[model samples]
Target: MSTTLSKSYYHATSSVSLSAVTTRDLLDSVAKKTPEKEAYIFPVEKVRLTFEELQRQVCTLGTGLLSIGLKRGDTLGIISSCAPEYIMVQLAAAYIGVVLARFHVGLPNSLLKSALLKSECVALVVGANNDDVYNQLELILPDLKTSHAETLQTDEKSKLQRIITNVEASQGRWKSIYDIMNLCKKDSENGKQRLEETSKMVEFGDPYTIFYTSGSTGPLKGTLHSHMAIQNIYMMCADRYEWTNDDILLSACSSLSHATSEMSHIAPLILGMTSVILSPGAKIHDNVSVIQNEHCTVLFSTYPGLYNLLHHGKINEYDCSSLRYVMTSASTIPTDVIQKVSSIFQAKVLHTYGSSEALFVSGRDITADEKEIIDKVGRPFGHTEVKIVNEYGKIVPINTQGELLIRSNFLFRYYIHDEDKTKQVMSVDGWYTSGDLAKIDRNGYIKIAGRSQDVIMKGGKTMYYASLVESLLSHPNVKAAYIVPVPDEELQEDFCACVSLIGDTSISSDDLKDFYKANIGIPAYIPKYVMVFDDFPEMLTGKMDQKMLTLEVFTRLGLNKEWLVHGRKA
Candidate 1:
């Protein structure tokens, strides 16, 4: 472990004393009460699992994990499609007190290697069905390199010694899905007995999950979150959203890769609701079908995925009367898009804003007049204390744009093994610097301006990517937009609009330019250019990689030779 600690204002306000129960405890609690009640329903496969059955499988595989010498505080890398057994592994890790770090399988080989290395994962668990992933890992095994490889691996002999568990097992190391389920059935007979012994040993505040933050600057960083932190976040968000035991939930976004799915899954599961797991490779068409067929009442998706759904024209065909709460985060949700979705689905469309370091800081009830709260990220998620602070750590007045800082019981434990990186965001006192700039109105509603890195300055006024992109997304013909700054001889930097048009909806550059000039309302003095791409390059977690886009533009525009700011002069 790293010895350095960075000062965060959040540390002074509170301690990491949140109470959390192990996954086994949670499953056992639900099993004892819900018993035969259905907890998960895989609508596509027509498969279902009762609480008792789910708990039964968890304990046995937990034994499978332990049988391979897997111990508490060890990390397991899980890369697979959404499966009952995959979920079982996560539960089993929580049950036995091992931390589960789920890797995004869709990431490029290089990025995936970065995550695996950064997490120092002892054993990697990939699904039997995903043979491609298995092959990819094997293909790159010997060549896998990272900064921490040597420090993370050694053949020391001690009871406290750490080594790879999943990959090094003499037997059952790469157990198949069928193998685990078969063993789970055999262990069901002793489930009750095993549960009793493990229940007494598990402790709250122990690390249960290590979620990697979607890095925009470099490789992703693993953020360690405790079981207690998970529970607190789940309870807070569930209460604020009025999530009930009966609500059917679905996530079109990468729930398996994000903290939203990480924490939000707890509520419906703990409350005895049936969770519908959308299949991998699920496009916009599949999403509509899943909601209609599964009778899904709540859907949590990112802005891009939702936008894709709207543009595909499949949303209106589905009988989506079952939906009640439709929440979006990760990126800004357009007001016009929000209003259209609400009108079509007749459900509440909520726009939420936060990060992996801090989940659900604020949300707006964007059920009506999407424009009203579209610019605003919304009010803080129930009881969360938010402040706009300047560089000196002093609070800025309302409506003044500054760094958005948050103080909540739900901050992450630490940036996993990266103290220097942890200090960059968290203060020793107890506040988390979001790296986002925002302002609050007298009504307590918060409106985001842009990310600190994404803000562009022209003349003396600053133009936020969020506001600029929001304007482009408002156009009926535009599907998605990215405002990437490019090099300029006059103003040091100019704005370039890279857009993805609606599917089958064609409009020329001149048409777009005319529309922007008439509708966007930007200053004429600022240099503006438009480039249309089939699709923007996206990070593994599905967020736009503006840095990559900038690099590509620099090369294409012949500006890389002398441009500052890598691609744009600043």
Candidate 2:
């Protein structure tokens, strides 16, 4: 089919049927259908939970939460790694209709406090192994140092209880998961009744979970999603990938805090597939060993994680023939890396496009021709509608880059406690402005250019750093490339290319600049300053930290605010 240019709007041709079932109900149904099936495996912790065992733990913990005065609409904050306890708390929170607020383990104390306070979480769950959590909790709750501070009283009398897992000690007001379970076991009859009633009350439209953005560029915002929206989005993902009950999925990119965790961990439980949760701080060899030992068939991680696995020299020592697909996203995938993944794993590489607001948007399978895999992000998701619009909000022609707008049933409900931020991105008509510059091809595939904020202006032309970086990555010696804007006298902004080369490649900055000028064929697009780095700063979510890199570049180059205001000569 030829591409059509009708306001640059395109809707997905395929759609999957969805059910009006809550996440709790879905899990129960799966447990009932396959009671003996393996649901979760934590190799690092040596923990395994079958479908029936998982449901039992969820029900017990959910009852314990309700016993501690947590009710529907109350929020439970989880700051932990990818462990069995984390999954238990998450499922229990969802089962009891409590809003699960996931806090990344890497978040600073200031952001962590802001997230918990803003979300008004009634309870906090932390893993004992996470030293940051212990350190931050002392600052957040000063009373903890005095004695066992069971609860923090708010104006509304919504007391916040602290629960810590994997430790036998319940010092200071912190309660252990074992203690909570014991409390529920002591009143098993009452807990069971309360759990059953609470589960029955939950509906598909109820708020399920809140995930905060990485906040690498701005303040963290908690994005909320309803049970129906998240569940169906994952269902669609499973359908798109044709995931089967026998498939074992491994998540190496993030823990429970990230959106990808839900796709790799939670969704697989409902589908009766095995989910292997790797512990944090796992190395490249650990990942490969998990896949080999677990006989994992599906792998979901960020581009860096996949890239590491592809180059981990010892990967060939493992029996990875069971792997069927390696799904990665969150940043640009180098063309060579994509090819290497396929060649090494003999599996399809899916380059997906998604965000905290919109769960799963579009994905391209790298098993296709090299050019198509490198150039496009696949078609619109089964139930998503995407469009490209210019500054005037008018539809742009096909293949013309503009800000992307998406309308999807799976879009987040709103930013918790931030109506102004919610209104900034969401329109009354249901369209969510992505703030990403992208273009749609005639054949309906979408290609992301770069964030609108990242566009560098040179002279009178707009230059997208992503395109330039992609070209630089195509060079054999270049391992990774990042483009940042620098103040210029003649041009509005000059380009600064920060690159890391393959081990001891002997490729210099001048050599890369010459290669770019020869290949890109744009004199202005060639970056004026080329900086070489052994490594780039990365955010918790595994994406390169562009904001930090830019700041560092300015500081190192002795560029000041005066230079930005009145060109570099100032």
Q: Write candidate 2's Cα lDDT for 1-570 as tens digits.
A: 234655578987555687688868878889999999889988888999999999888888888888888899889888887478788888888998999998888777777777878888877887867765666676766654455446654344334655555433334356666667677988889889998998899999999999888775479999999998888888877877888898899988655688877886666555889898887767778888888899999888878777667666378888889999988865466767877887888988887888899888888643355576565677666788999999999999988989999998899999998999999999999999988889988767788887877777788677687887876676778888898789877786787889998777787778887888788766887888888898898777666787789888888888775655465321
**In TM-score terms, which candidate is top?**
2
As a whole number from 0 to 100, the lDDT of residue 479 in candidate 1 is 78
Which regions of candidate 1 deviate over 4 angstroms?
1-20, 143-173, 177-196, 365-372, 524-527, 561-570
Candidate 1 local lDDT, 1-570, one digit each (tens) = 011122211111112233456566677788898889777766545678788888777777776666555677788888866556567777888888888887776667887766766676777777655656755764446322222342233223212222222322212334554454455456554644554565467787788788777777566878787776677666656666677777878866654767776644576455677777665556677777888887888887778777777778477688888898788885465667777778888888877787778776877643334555666766665446777878787877767877889877667878876899889888888878888877876556677777777767665456788877877776687877887676566766667778888777878766787778887666642237777788888877777887789878767777664454355423
RMSD of each: 6.4, 2.7
* Weakest ten-residue segment in model 2 by summed lDDT: 164-173
